[model samples]
Target: MAISDVPPADCPPWLVPVHTLLLGIGVLCWDATYILMTRRALATKSYGMPLLALAVNLSWEMVYVFYVCEAVLETTGFFVWLLLDIGLVYTTIRFGPHDWKDSSPWVGRNIGCILGLLTAVGCVGHYTFAVWWLAEPGRGIGGDKRGKWWQGREGLDTTELAFWSAGLSQLNLSAGSVAMLLVRGHSGGTGYAIWFFRTMGTLFGLILDNAFMWWYWPAGYGFIVSPFAVFIWGTSMACDIVYPFLLWQVRRTELLLPDGRLVRCDSQPASTASSDHGKKKR
Candidate 1:
C-alpha cells in the first residue's frame, strides 16, 4: 500500500491536503537542489557536495531504496535521488581532486578510492541501524497506531526512520557546504542558486515539514520539537543562511577561469596570475 492509502489514523481528513502540500514542496525543492548542484558541478568542473556528506547521503538513499521503504511513491523518490546522487558522485570523482590539490595532495590523488571506501562503510552502517531499529516491535511502531506509524499501511515507521537519517544527512550537508566554501576560498561548483534551493529545500523538507507534522500529529512527531531535532535542523538552517553572504564576499576576490577553475585574483601579480592560470589549464 502507499502513503496516500494510509494517512496517519489520527490525522483529520481535512488536514491531509495541507500535509501533502508541505511535504510536496519540500520534496520538490530538494530535487531542484540536486539538479542545480549537478549542473553547477558540471559547469564548474568541481564537486558540489562535500565528500563525507555525499557518502552519508548516498548510503542512506541506497539503504532506503533497497530495504527500508516499501511504498511505491516513497521508493520511487528515493530511487530518483539515488540516481541524481550518482551524477554528483561522478563529478566528485572526476573533479574533486582539483579542489584538494594544494592543501591535501594525497587526498586529491586518491579521492575516488577514499570515497568508495567511505560509501561502502556508510552503506553497512545504515543497513545495520535499520535492521536494529526495525527488529524492535514498539520502536518501529513509535508507540501506537494512532501515532505517526499509521501513515504507512505497513507497521514500519519509515517516516521516523527517514526523519532521523535525513536529519543527520541535512546537518552534514549544510555544515560541509560551509566548511567547503571557506576551505576552497572561492565559489567553484557552488553559487547563489545552489544556496537558495538548498536552504528552501531544507526549510520545506526538514523544518516546516516536521513542524507541520508535529502540529497535526503530536503523538508520533513530538520528536520534531525535541531539543536534538531542533538543534540539528536549527544549526543547519543557520549555516545555510550564512553561506550566500560569504559567497558574495569570496567572489569579490576570486576569478572564474574559462576552463572552470576559480583562482585568487586579489593577492597575486598579473604575471603570476597569468602563469598560474596557464598551468591550471594545462
Candidate 2:
C-alpha cells in the first residue's frame, strides 16, 4: 500500500498536528492578507491583489475543502479558508473595477466581471488538473516530471497537489501584491498591515516548504525530485525572498495626504516629503 493510501486515522497524531500547524498557520496568514486587501479596496476604492491570484486562491480553497481527503487538521483549515474566500471574491468583484474607473465606469465593471468569470473557469481547470495529477502513481520521480518507478494503489496525493497549486498561488501572491503596490505608486489601500500579514504568510510558507521537503519527500520512493516540486517551491522561495525588500522600498515612498490619507510619496506634492522630514527633525 502506498503512503497516499494510508487512511487518515492511521496517520500519526504527531504528523497530522505538525502538518496542520505548519500549513494551517501559513494559510491563516494568507487569509489575513486577503481580509486586509478587502478592507483596503473598500476604503481606497482600489484593488490590492491581482484578480488572477485571488481567483486562483479561491479555487484552491474550494478544492481542498470540498474534494480533497478529509484529514481532520488539514481539511479543517481548508474549510475555514473556504468560508473566508467568499468574502474575498465579493471584495475582488466590488473593488477591482474602480481601479479602471478613469477609463469608464463600464470599463471597470467589465474588468471585474471578466475576472470573476475567468476565475470561475480557472476553478474548474484547477480542479481538473489536481484530479489528473493525483491519479498518477507516486512512483520514484526522476529528473523527468512523471516517473514510472512503481504501480501502487490508485489514489490522490492531496498534500502534493496543494503544494503545487495552492502553494504556488501563494508564492505568486507575495510578489504580485507588492508589484501592484509599486505599479500604482501608491500605498493608499495597501499599508503596513497588508505587508505585515504578507510577511507572516511568507515566513510560514518557508516553514511549510522545509517541513514537507524534509519530512514527506518521496516516502517510499528513493529521493524523487519531481519537476513540480522544483518549479513550485523553487520559484516560490525566490519570490518570497524578494517580497520583503520590495515592501521596504514601497514603505520609503509612502506619504500622508492633507486629508489624512496615505499614498505613495510620489503621489503627493514635493513639499510633502520635505515637510514630513522637517517635522521628524523637530
Candidate 3:
C-alpha cells in the first residue's frame, strides 16, 4: 500500500473524533498516576505485585506510542509489535513473582523465557520478511491482488508466534491468580482486589485478541475488516489503561511489617506443626 493509503501524517482523518478524545483522556490519567506513584516517598519501598502491573501498563504504552507515530507504524508496525512482545516478556521476567518460593515464580519465569525466545525468533523472521517484501513487493504467497507486501506473510508468522507467547503469558497470569486466591487470607485485601482486576482485565484482553487473530485467519482479513481492527486496537489500549490504575491502587494500600519492612507472603500451604501451634495459641 502506498503511504497515502494511511491516514494523514498530521492526524489520521479516518480516526473518529471520539477515539482521539478517549485516548487523550486515558493517556492523561495514566501519565499523571504513574508520575505520582513513582515520585511518592514510598516508591523506594517494595510495591509487591503492583510493580508487575505497572510494567505491563508501560509495555502497552510503548505499543500505543508506536501505533500513533505514522512513520513508525507505516515502516515497521509488525516489528514494533514484536519488539513490544519482547518488552512484555522482559517485564514479566523482572517483576512477575512476589517471592522466590512461590509456585508462580517458577511458572512465570519459565513462561517469560519461552516468550523471550519466541519474540527473538519473530524479530528475525519479520526482518527477513521485510527485506524480501522490499525486494519483490508484487510477489505473493497466494494469487491475491493485494500483493505480497500487504499480505504480511512474514508478519503473520510473527503474529502466530506472538499468539502462543500471549497464550503462555495468560497461563502464567492464571497461575498467579490462583496462588493469590489460595493465599487471600494472608494478603492485604487491597492486594487481592488488585490481582482480581488485573487478571480479569488481562483475561478479557487475551480472549478478545484471540478472537481477532482467529477472525483474520484462512486468508487474513484485518485489512478488510475495519471494525475488527478497531476492536482489537481499542481493546489493547484499554488493557494499557486498566493495568496501571490497578497497580497504583495496589501500591497505595500495601501492608508493612512490624519493623517497617515490607512483608512478602508465600502461597505454600502451612505445615501441620505451624497449624498446631496456631491452634494452641488461639
Candidate 4:
C-alpha cells in the first residue's frame, strides 16, 4: 500500500510535554521582547510601519498558537481557531504594508492590493464554510461524504477548507514579507534573518502537516504520529523565542526612514553609494 495507507501510531512519548514546554517558553520570550523593543523604538523615534507589521504578525501568531493547543482540536477549539485565523488574514491584508508607488504600474500597488484583498476574501470564505459545517454537522458538502463534522474525518469540503486556508495563509505571509522587504529596502540586516527563520518555520510546519495527512490516508491510523502537529507546536515556540531577539535588534538599530518606511542598507559599493545619496537627498 501507499504511504497514505499507513496507520498512525500512538502519540509519541516526547510529543506533548516537549511541545507544551516549547509553546509556553516561546510565548514568554515573545512577550518580553515585544515590550522591550517597542519601548526602545518609541524612545529612539525609529518606529515605522515595519514595526507595526511585525507586531501584528507576532500577535496573531501567539493567538494562533494558543488556539491550536487549547482550542482547535476540540469542538470549541475549531470555532475559536477559525475566528482567530480570520482575524489574522484580515489584519495581514489590511494593515500589512505595500510599496506600489516604487514599482512598475503593471506589478505596482494596485496589483498587490488586489491580491491582498482576494486573499482576505478567500480566507473569509473558507472560514464561512467551516462555520457552516460546524453549524450543520451532517450537511453534505465538499468531501464530507459521511456528513459527520466532529469526527475530524478528511472529507472533500473540510479538505477544501484546509487547502484554501493553508494556501491563503502562505500567500498572505509571502506578500507581507515582500512588502516589508521592499519598504525597508536593502539595510534590513538581521530583519532578513527574522523573516528567513519565520518563513522557514511556516513552510516546515506546512510540509509536516501535509505529510501527516498523506500518511494517515486510506485505512491508516497515523494521526498518532502527528509530526505536523508537533512541528507546529515547536515552531510556534521558536517563533516566540526568536521574535523578541529580532525585535530587540530592530529597536536598537536606526532602521526607519523619515517617510515612516523601514530603511534597508545596501552592502555593495554601487548600491551603497546610491542609497547613501538617496538618504542624503531625503
Which one is best on lDDT? 1
Per-residue CA lDDT of model 3 for 1-282, tens digit only, reads 222122223433543333334323433332333233223213323223232332333343343233322334333543433343343334334444443335455645565564445545544543454345445433333322231122343222222223333433344444443344334323322233344444444433344433433343323323323454445444544544454454444334443443232333332236532453222110
Task: List lDDT for all candidates, in order.
Answer: 0.76, 0.58, 0.36, 0.38
Please write out the lDDT profile of model 2 over residues 188-264, one tens digit for every residue: 55667777777667566544543553354344222324455556556656765665676667656665455434555
Models 1 onward score TM values of 0.88, 0.72, 0.35, 0.39
Model 1 regions more than 4 Å off: 1-10, 140-155, 266-282
Better of 1 and 2 by TM-score: 1
Clashes of each: 0, 1, 0, 15
Instruction: Please give, for residues 52-133, the per-residue lDDT of candidate 4 as tens digits.
Output: 3433343333333432222333224234433433433343333333333344444343443554554455445554655665
Off by over 4 Å in 3: 1-15, 32-98, 104-255, 259-282
lDDT of 1 by residue, 1-282 (tens): 115424565678766567657777877887888888888888888888999999999998999898887767778888988877877888898997877877898999999999999989989988998887676445632344333342343455556667788888899999999998887777777888889988988888777866776687766566677778889998999999899888887777776665767765553447756775522311
Which candidate, 2 or 4, has the higher lDDT? 2
- Alpha-carbon error at 189 in model 1, in Å? 0.7
Cα shift from native, residue 242, model 3 (Å): 12
